[model samples]
Target chain A: MFAEVLTIGDELLTGHTVDSNSAFIASKLTEQGYWVRRITTVGDDVEEIKAVVGEILARKPEVLVISGGLGPTHDDVTMLAVAEALGRKLVLCEKCLERIKAFYEKLYSEGYIDDPSLNEGRKKMAYLPEGAEPLENTGGAAPGAFIEHKGVKIFVLPGMPREMKAMLEKEVLPRLGRRKFLQRKFLAEITDESKLAPILREALERFNVRIHSSPKGFGKYIGLIIFAEDEGELEKTVEYLESRGIRLEEA
Target chain B: MFAEVLTIGDELLTGHTVDSNSAFIASKLTEQGYWVRRITTVGDDVEEIKAVVGEILARKPEVLVISGGLGPTHDDVTMLAVAEALGRKLVLCEKCLERIKAFYEKLYSEGYIDDPSLNEGRKKMAYLPEGAEPLENTGGAAPGAFIEHKGVKIFVLPGMPREMKAMLEKEVLPRLGRRKFLQRKFLAEITDESKLAPILREALERFNVRIHSSPKGFGKYIGLIIFAEDEGELEKTVEYLESRGIRLEEA
Candidate 1:
């Protein structure tokens, strides 16, 4: 299966924040046996988000995970943009409204916020695209979204790492089925960096595994990662490479 | 002016590596007054790289920065893919071959590598797309390439952070003339996060500034970043936000 990731935020485009969230999402998706083909990052404008969502849907990936721009600020226009891009209208979910109200009241009671009533910006968090299931946020006020549009599973998550990680674990992972892919990292002790290329090429033609290699340094070791659907295939590939006189140790 | 960053590597797609290089390039481009519109990450496959490169060129960005896959491994096919995408041929740079020869001999002298001979894989690093200028790699062996195609300045650099940063600062930045953009961060003391939306909207209409706000926590302060072309406009926007009763402290 193939997947795509879209991360949205002005801070990302401005380089004020490094996008570690996309890598976290991609790693989790890869573990679930989905080959994440692309990861795209854009700013918090409606037009930009809509255009990107449209382009991604045209690619027709099986799973699309989108993170960031789900807060209650003026720049948090991801939900609206996603709705418009899918040709759906933003409809208020009553249950999400109740949850957001409770979240704010709890904060106000703890003397963290000044007001408990839901203002315009707070109320905006309760709306999602039509026919979307609201994904609960355990650590924050804004709820995530899960929608299936034209056979693509789209998930919109919060920007905060804490909320995003919790929702992805409890809500997102459960929806995606349970097929796992195994990947192993190794350090190949090859003094001549260029000499391992032909051996790697031969191993790829013989094994049903995906291999990636990079020079760790000018030293005797290079980094190698082999990915396979099962442990047996992974072991076979490793054995084949070792038999070719390229010493490899688990890294 | 607008720019785009495309980072190519299989490790990034597998979530084994985080893409800090894109952010570094974005921050530098933003400082040079170019809005980095998007950042894309893909694997090392030739077809995938060619497809993505074609798409980015179709967008016609003023500048495009591509990093990674410029090594002596079998998987480092980025140069070939880029050449094919642009409908050009990979031509050998004689000076680059001489430089590569010296580099390997030095490594052999230092006992870093077993062979000093110019093998096929090592010799592959000397080829660049026809009609492109070679950018020196101060930290590594593979020389970068710079090409101007259809009004877009395309820069191809190595994936190693040390090499990429040195090339970008020395070679890439000098070619891009200096016209700076200013950005300032602040902690706006607003207990109700939603209430600051209208004030930010008003500030945007009154001043030529871009503002991004995020909730720091449920506490009194919220994070704000204001971007402008000049210092006077940035200061005016800050003063206006302060006058609207949002206490802002430089952060």
Candidate 2:
């Protein structure tokens, strides 16, 4: 399946933030056999966000994952943009409100804040899409939301790495666990590409592999990847490469 | 100005490669007042490359930067993809071939390789899109290519970070020196969002600044960013916030 990652924040565009969240999410999705076609980073401008979202949706990717803008402030426009793109309505989720209230009460009891600020923090996380499923936030105040529209699954996640990771692992993974996947990789120590050209061409002919060669400090390394339905076909391909003196490393 | 980044490699999609090239390019582009609206990462698939290139052209971004697949092996299909996307033909550049031959001859004279794969390496990098301008590669074997199509400039660089960075710094930055940019950032001490809400809101209204709060650690720290066309306006905004006891620390 193909996916697109949208990382929302002005800090990302300004060079103040590194945007580790996209890399993290892309890595996880790729391991599960999802092809991340594009990663778009935009500031908090609603028009820009809406425009990019509309463009990505037109591409008809299987999934669109967005990270950022789930905060209590003005720059938190991610939900608003998603709603605008999908033509949904924004509403206060009562269950999310209750959870936020409980979290605030715990913070109050622990002397982390006064009652006034606690209430505001709780209210900050109460907003959600009208019919979206609010994924419980065990790591932070803002709960993530998941919704489906036009055959594309949209996951709106917090910008914080810890919070996004927890929700993705606990809530998102289970929902996508049924998708079958095959992971294959090849490693070669040859530095010169010309020397390995004939071998790579032969391997490509015999196996359904997409090869990548990266030049490292010591030598150039090549990676060959393939996806198969059954373990038998996967093994046979691995054996074929092994007979040709290519190392099929475990991914 | 607007730009789009294209990172090409199967390893990037397969989780074996983390695309630092896009982030680095994005940072540089943003610094130069060029907004990087979309970044596409594709495998070595020629069709996918062509599709993304078409999409990028449709967006009419002022600049298009692509990295990877400039190697000599069978899997390196960037030249072919670029030719297909721009409706051009791939032909060997005689100047690039001569340079590569000279580089390899130097390496061989130094006893780097008795039976050098110099011709193969040169052949891999010599091909270019018809009428494309060559960007000098001071660091590696693969020289970058630059082409202008329908008023949109397309830059193709090798995937290796060292080569890409060198070309960006030496070639891209000089060409982008004509644009003016204003970026102002403030770092504030960690505080709860609720407690700082009133101050932040007042600061935003009083100075017309945009604030983004991100929780940092046990004590939450916030980052405020303001963008403007005039440097004097940005300074005045910063001064106004500081005068209001917002404790602005320049970042």
lDDT of each: 0.92, 0.75
Tens-place lDDT digits, model 1, residues B1-251: 78999999999998889999999999999988888899999999999999989999999999999999999999998999999999999999999999999999998898888789999898999999999899999888999999999999999999999999999999999999676577888999988778999999999999999898988777788989898887998999988988999999999
A229, model 2: CA deviation in Å?
3.9
Compute DockQ for each candidate against the true complex: 0.84, 0.46
Which whole-number lDDT from 0 to 100 does residue B171 have in model 2?
82
Consecutive 10-residue window with the lowest summed lDDT within model 2 chain A: A209-218
- Name the regions of candidate 2 deviating beyond 4 angstroms: A114-124, A189-191, A218-221, A245-251, B106-114, B118-122, B194-213, B218-220, B243-245
lDDT of 2 by residue, B42-136 (tens): 77878989988998898898999899988766777898899899999988888988887786676667765444545554586898999898888
Best by DockQ: 1
Against the true structure, what is each candidate's TM-score? Answer: 0.97, 0.89
Off by over 4 Å in 1: A230-233, B230-232
Interface RMSD of 1: 1.0
Local lDDT at A183 for model 1: 84
Residue A227 in candidate 1 has what lDDT? 86
